[model samples]
Target: MIVGIDLGTTNSLVAVWRDEAPQLVPNVLGSVLTPSVVGLDDQGQVLVGQAARERLQTHPQLTAALFKRHMGSAQEIALGKRKFRPEELSALVLRSLKEDVERAFGEPVEEAVISVPAYFSDAQRKATRIAGELAGLKVEKLVNEPTAAALAYGVHQKDKETSFLVFDLGGGTFDVSILELFEGVMEVRASAGDNFLGGEDFDTALIQHFVSSQRQDKHFPDVNVPGMRNRLRCEAERVRHALGQQPTATFSLAQGGRQWELAISQDDLQHVSASLLERLRGPVERALRDARIRVADLNEVLLVGGTTRMPLIRKLATTLFGRFPAMHINPDEVVALGAAVQAALKQRAAALEEVVLTDVCPYTLGIETVEQFGRVLESGHYLPIIERNCVVPVSRVKTIQTLHDNQTHVLVKVFQGESRLVKDNIALGELSIPVPARPAGEVELDVRFTYDNNGILEAEVKVPASGEMHHLVIENNPGVLAPQEVRQRLAALAQLKVHPRDQMVNTTLVARLERLYQEHLGEVREMLGNMAGSFQQALASQDVECIAQMRESIAHRLDELERSPWQ
Candidate 1:
């Protein structure tokens, strides 16, 4: 009765607990995917999923797909008269998914376990919870997408205690996770990802290719259109998707009303995306450095997301890791399945308590200070306050001598990133590690970093001699705007009738959700029948109130199902 949903930045998906396993549901289009799109029809009614996505090619002005990128930001996109905020738009996507699940079962769905990126901050995670609430289904658990994927792979066909890395490259975000599969338990040892990277970068690479190929093509062409840039961007995306396995893809684009056809080989597409592909190495390398391990030590490199289907990605991964990556679980649907299992466990629906998943904070959180060389202490130095891949139920304490003799209080600047320079990184927040005046190196500043089952970081600094203690989380956090702020700006942005953009989370969300829905139709249908018999009849009898009531009832059932479906 309960399903797991992966609300990705470029796409979305829904799956359910089944026969002691997780299965994805498919949409009505006979594909295990539905685009995460929404648009006003010609008649002013709203259309979502595949239909909304189709409108993108022609009705680019009205449709909005891939709004997930703006999740933690204060960006607001306008569609029509309604100035829907990101959370509201996200809720609409979840609502559409709810309807899809209902159609699959002819009953109402009430509960769900949703998956989000492991690196999502508290604000982003909270926003996701609210989106689930607005959709009328209870959120059983907010499982991290990477961790879920790990569980989906690690939980069954089980493994002994061993460490493996998960390379998750979706359409909008990329995450590298190291996990320890131990005695039926899946624990995240460390995680790092780039929110701005993924399949979208590949599209940009291809766009660069097209622009380069046209360097001197003077075949009656100025190559300009009011929306030429956007059109080329769309075409580039199409080509990237087509070149997944095919040796070649031929795409003709009409830019500025002038048509140009390019016969792109896989090699050509690969070359275009080479730079973007190159960018992934930094994060992957940084993560390994943080984990203090080489790729050769990994037991397996599991790939997650649709983009992993590409040949070059696989080749690059094999080249870097010196081993072939594992595949079988649908890259798009695995996260959703793992989410469902997590939901079931959270609700106590399954006897999986022995299964423990410990995830690490993706970003290094610390206070800023200057080095003797006039260097600044930055967040991404890879000198983790708590090193990545250190086993859980662990805490580390470090002490440093005060630099100044007369310092009464020390100012602390916290940051997140892999950069060495303070100016080149993100400031998480600021703090003052209090200390009494003393000669240089006379006072010891004690700092402790502790990590729980979840990877959230909390810092405690002690001026032991003065009995002064500073307890706080990481600082300099501008990564995610507050929810109220995102909402307020989103409402205002709605009035301008700004064009809906494809940020990409919606694209991945659609693909993932559709795949999940199709895999778990049988259980979903039976639950729908049991939850809304009268409503099903009303749907047939044209009774609005009964249908609405049944809808509410189905949602409640889903909520219950989400808490613990197997139980």
Candidate 2:
């Protein structure tokens, strides 16, 4: 079965279209929300999801989270003794989700439709595809998260006609998309976003506040300790989530032989996060301006993503459009459901037979050229062949003459972005085509760019005079992994030992206990350590009922301890 995956920065989920509707697949833990974290246990076994997330507070050196923010970069994170790329970390999460799908369907699955941010550049998109390949899944399509949300929303309103704006602010990215729906057709008019802005940044803001406050009192925590930042981050998230529901929450951390707490209110969060809020405005305004639709003309505004659960974000949306946005769909699961819809559409499912979809290229794509200013020529100018937000499966062409006399060949450097200069844009690839060496303007070249719904771009250069043509699909992009590198990564991934699926419950419990143990001191720390030992001894007994009973008993105690307010 072809599954739909929302490989998000903070969490990931898998869904499939079945029985004329989309259904989320539950993981082994019987939960649809799987934390996007990966780690190595003390025994060097691979751990993912909740287990990995728990270890972030105890075995921070052996775990990695939030790698999604560095998707297309060359940076490598150390997970224990091994170093892994962001794509590699992402693949681990995908592999875990793949196993979840197989367990749910009782069959082997190999193909998937994955969702990504709308404004992801070519490098980021390519990196996402490579992550799928590394996870042993054939990526059928990379659907933009906002577009996928619209597709899922459109599935419910296929018979109606309307225009809407999708505001998607997730764990680590923000996207705004303007769309129109009519007669079972969903068209994305424009897409824009900041890949670096989201809920994670809010956590960082809280962290900074706590740190700055501590500094004023001449008290400093040894943040250089491997797990200190993780502890602070956990508190920050707790405070952020608490503030979402209540007017105030305390950010508390135990460090430097004392308990540090700062009471933060909703207004304080908004004040400290002002810059991020401003960043959100730019993308929304740009998308509206690109779509040429006014706020008054939009029939509805839809909010998608877990970050939108914050009242601050909702308030911002309300103030922007002068209307309360719609949230009929579950923000967290909407993208995965939409991906399942896309998967069904790919198979031409009968329920979606009348549905048609069109998406835009989220960024401008073109070739670098020289602009003539009277007798002087200035290079580095960007000539757009396909402007941003143009509907895809689109092809656009531009013609240009050579700049110098006897130019033997014209080098076409392709780029993507809205900057006027190529220097400010992202270089995708370059192609050199031979000319007849005719004087300056005598040689004319035709450049064509074709963008598809899946966000792949193809560039073709044709020398009409010499009948010479060259085509490029941008495989040499610096951000993409080489074929050999992919093979080597595959080999390396194969060598890692994955923790047995049947023992996940015990693994997760142990990780949780370890984290709790690290958070307390004296009597509480001793109690947690003793509890962990008892659980480990129960597992060693090899008695199913004994282990099950002990697990329930210890889990209850942990829950009680967790529910208590921090010191």
Candidate 3:
């Protein structure tokens, strides 16, 4: 069966349509959420999810997390002895989710609908598709995360005609989408976001505060060390979560034979994270402006993503919209659940036969042109063929005159972005048309861009005079993969080996102990080392009861270490 996957920044999850509703598929750990982390064990076996995440604290140099922020870039993450592209790591995560769902359903699943940030560029969207393909799943669709969340919410509210705003703040990306539901149609009016903003930034803020405070007290660890920085990030995340549930929280760090304790208050969190809160307003305002709707016009504001649980964020959203945001669904799982609903719709499920989903191009599609303004030749000017927020599966044509006398050809350089300057926008592709030589303004050509629902752009230049057309299916742009490259990468990724599923629990425990062992010194270090040795002996025995007891002892020792201060 086809499923929906949320390949998130901090956590990934899978969901499928079952019994007329979307149901989450638990991982081997019996948890719906899997930490989006990838690493390698000491034995050089690939590790994913909780196991990899635990290694982050002690083996930071051998682990990769939060690669989603670099989705469209050429950046490579160095994990253990291997180097991998962001999409490659993402492919591993998708493969893990695929394996989980298959094991849970006792069947082989081959297709899926994956969710992405609504504001992701064409290159980013294409990268996501390539990742899915590499994971051995046929990606039928790439649904915008906020749009998917709206669908998950709208499916239950079919009887009501309403307009709502979806504010999505995930681990590493934030997207704001305006949607309208009426007469069995769910339409996305506008979407905007900052790919670099999200829950991680809040963690960074707290980390910085602690660092600055500790530096003043002269007791901070050297954060330049990857392990130390990751440890602080872990503590920061804990503090961020604790502050969400209470007025204050304390985080302790052991560094250089000293224990440092920091108390963070809710007010301190708001103060340190104020700038991030402000960044949220820009996208919200832009989405509303593009939709031509005021805050009062919105029937509701829906919150999505785990970050929205922060009281300060909720308060800010309420203040901006003049209404409390709706939390009718679990913010973290809603996007994946909606992705399942979309998958069902793709299959033409009987329950959603009347539901129609329409999405818009989040940015304007245009071409660069050189125009003569009363004797001045202006270059780098953007002439929009299709405006932002225009419903997709759409085509727009704009006729332009040649810029110079006797111009033999016209060049159409396609771009996508909201900027008025072509240089400021993302270049998609270009095409040159052979035009009949004529005086400026006498030679005309039609430049058309067709943006499909899959977020792919196709550009065509038509010379009506000679009935000659030049067409280009925009692909292989910078940061995007060529078809050949995608195939090659898929083949390479398919051959990479993951740790055996049945041994994951034992592997994870060992990795955690290895990390904790490195974090301690003196007696504690020796204690952990002995425990590891004993656990190894028990594992070699292959006795179920012995292994279980050793596992419990190791867990208790680790817990005690976490609570103990450095000597």
Candidate 4:
């Protein structure tokens, strides 16, 4: 059965269309949300989800988190003795979710509709598809996260014609989309976002504040130590989550024979993360502007993603739109659920036969050209073919003549972004075609770019006189993996053994205890060690009830240790 997956930054989830509704699939931990983390255990088995996330605190050198931020780059996450590209790490998360869904459904999942941030570049989107391929799932479509959220909400509100703004702030990316639901069609009017702005930045800000505060007291923890930075990051995330529910949160850390404690209020968090909050405005304003609508024109503001759970973010969004945002669906699950809806739509499910969804290209697509201004000829100028926020499944063409006399060859360099200069934009690919030698400005080539609903681009350059044409499917670009490389990596990843699904809960518990053992000292360390030993013994006994009881006890004890003021 085909399912939908939200391959998120902080957490990932899967859902399927069942009994006329989308239902979330629970993982081995019996939770819908799985941490998007990957690591190597002492036995060199790949650990995913909570277990791997916990391992990040004790074995920083052997774990990777937040690799989503580097999806399309050359950056690699080094775990143990091996290095993995961002997509490889992402593939592990996808595989874990796929396994969960397979076990839950008692069937093999072959196809999926994966969601991505609306503003993700072409390279990032491609990486996501490759990741799915590596996980043995055919990615049928790459739905925009905000668009999926809108679809999930709009499907239930199909009776009304309404315009709404979707503000999606996730762990590693932010996206703003303006959508209008009229008749049976849900059309995304405009899309904008900051790929690097999200909840993680807020966590980083808090971590910095704690570090700086400790430095002032001369009890600074060496953040450069293997696991120290991750420890601080984990604590910072806890504080961020705590402040979401309460007025203040306290954080305590022990390192290098010194203990540090800090209390951060909600106000303090807002003040520290003010810049990130401000950054959110740019995308919102740009989306509204692009949609040719004012804030007052919007019927509602929809919030999506766990980051939007923060009161500070809610306040900022309310202040911007002068209205409270809607929280009808769980922000974390909305995208995945919407993806399921899209998957159903793809299959032409009877329940959604009348529902039609349309998306927009989040960035401009163009070609590099030379512009002549008086006596100066400026090369590397970007000429737009399809502007940003334009409706998808669109075909736009622009014609240009030869640059110089008897120019026998014309180069077509395709790019994406809204920039005046080509150098400032992302170059997709380039093709050089030979043309019959003609006088300057005599030979004109029709450059056409077609962007489909899935956000994939196809560029074609045709010369009518010579009946010559060059077409590019626009799959492999610089910085993105080629098809062969993706297949190679797929085979390599298939060989890496993932920790058995049945042992995930126990593994997660032990990883947490191990991390705590490394963080504490003296009595606390000894206590954690003993508890871990008992848990291991219980696991050896293979008594389901006793092992479960031990796990619960150990988890509660770890929670107590984490909350204790005395490190």
Q: Pick the candidate with the highest lDDT.
A: 2
Q: Model 2: residues >4 Å from true position, as ranges?
A: 473-476
Model 4 lDDT tens row, 79-114: 989889999999999988888888987999999999
TM-score of each: 0.72, 0.97, 0.94, 0.96
**For residues 516-554, what per-residue lDDT tens digits would candidate 2 score against the true structure?**
887787788899999999999998999999999999999
Separately for all candidates shown, the number of backbone clashes (residues 3 or more apart, or on different chains) is 54, 0, 0, 0
lDDT of 3 by residue, 438-491 (tens): 887887888888888888777888888878988966644557777897888888
Better of 1 and 4 by lDDT: 4
Comparing 2 and 3 on lDDT, the stronger one: 2
Candidate 2 versus the native: TM-score?
0.97
Q: Cα RMSD to native, each candidate?
A: 11.2, 1.5, 2.4, 1.7
Query: What is the alpha-carbon lDDT of model 1 when measured against the actual structure?
Result: 0.67
The true-structure Cα RMSD of candidate 4 reads 1.7
CA lDDT of each candidate? 0.67, 0.91, 0.88, 0.90
Best-to-worst ranking by TM-score: 2, 4, 3, 1
